[model samples]
Target: MKILCISDQIDPLIYSNTIKDRFSDMDLVLSAGDLPLDYLEFIVTTLNKPLLFVFGNHNLKELPFYRHSFEDRFRFYSPQEERDALTSGAIHVGSKIHREGNLIVMGLGGSLRYNNGPNQFTNRQMNFEILKLVPRLLFNKLVYGRFLDILLTHAPPLGIHDKEDPCHRGFKAFLWFMRLFKPRFLIHGHIHLYDLQDVRTTKYHETQVINAYSHYIIDTGAAS
Candidate 1:
């Protein structure tokens, strides 16, 4: 299956087909937050594709309606499954081993800290959550032996993907998780630079880290 990833910007096509016109080739969409609700609605309506996303620090009041809209296609991860977690979030898709097929994926939506919202978790508080969830809830799947196909988190992993700005905080625990799990891919959003550059890729610890924004596509089925 093909996966199209995006984040840190508003979906430009809801008003019409402006953004969608450029990215008609994507089979599935994964958003990393900082987008408009109408843009999401457009994905369900005009684009008519499956989407998964996490919120950025700036996005507000979008969670309730988002879950209500794409009840089946949207997935967000929790502190229970990962130390890095987000509020106003839900887990909508596959797991580590699960991505082997359509590719199992899990996501933590929202930013490093909540400027405002309901389900936000602090960095330290998030670590406490990971301490509670790991060894118990994590690594219990088919991908446990080697590596998970994909591990999605709203927070970027530490210095690996971080930029040099105050608002550009990266998730340390996420980096730790990347080193430990060694998933085939690490997907995330939040950094504005990455959102603007339109593409960022790194080969770290045997995994491919990608920042998906406005328009991105990959045919994973044929890659392996």
Candidate 2:
């Protein structure tokens, strides 16, 4: 299956009329974080595909809309609620496990705690968040023969694609998650790559870590 992953910045190629023609064959859309809701809405309306996303440290004005009710933690938005939220039918999968067909994806959206800010978490907090998903992941392993297929986040894993700065530094818990659950992909967005030569994709153990700075296309062998 073909998936379109976007984050951090808005790409003209995706925000234009030509987007339909450009990515018409994509089976799914995943947003790593830090993108405007309107940009995500446009993609949802244009592509008319399943768009699952997490919240980054920035551009999260609509975050509250996705969390208006505590029940949102267990259920997806109804059709009317989705329209009312004005996210153009996109779904926020932050800190949740979402299953699309046979693909299992878990999201942990936030940056390393550097200051008082929304969507920022300390390493211990992030680890606790992961612990919350243990029961579900274990169930998935028994039923599907794997814990997860994708580990989606706003920050990269420590020492992989992360920087030395506190804000941009990745979570050490993510490395532990990989060692345990062994997801096929750990896709994140936080550090912006300016130079073309800067690395964006790396392989660590059984997972492929990717930086979805602007946009990227991933072709997975899994069924849609």
The top-ranked prediction according to lDDT is 2
lDDT per residue (tens digit) for residues 46-94 in model 2: 9999999999999866676664535446756566755656645778889
For residue 177, give model 1's deviation from the true position in Å. Answer: 0.7
- Candidate 1 global CA lDDT score: 0.57
TM-score of each: 0.68, 0.91
Give residue 63's error in model 2 in angstroms: 1.4
Error of 1 at 34 (Å): 1.6
Candidate 1 off by > 4 Å:
11-22, 64-101, 114-120, 128-140, 143-147, 194-199, 222-224
Candidate 2 residue 4 C-alpha distance from true site, Å: 0.4
Give residue 47's error in model 1 in angstroms.
Answer: 2.3
Shift in Å, residue 45, candidate 1: 1.6
Model 2: CA > 4 A from native: 67-87
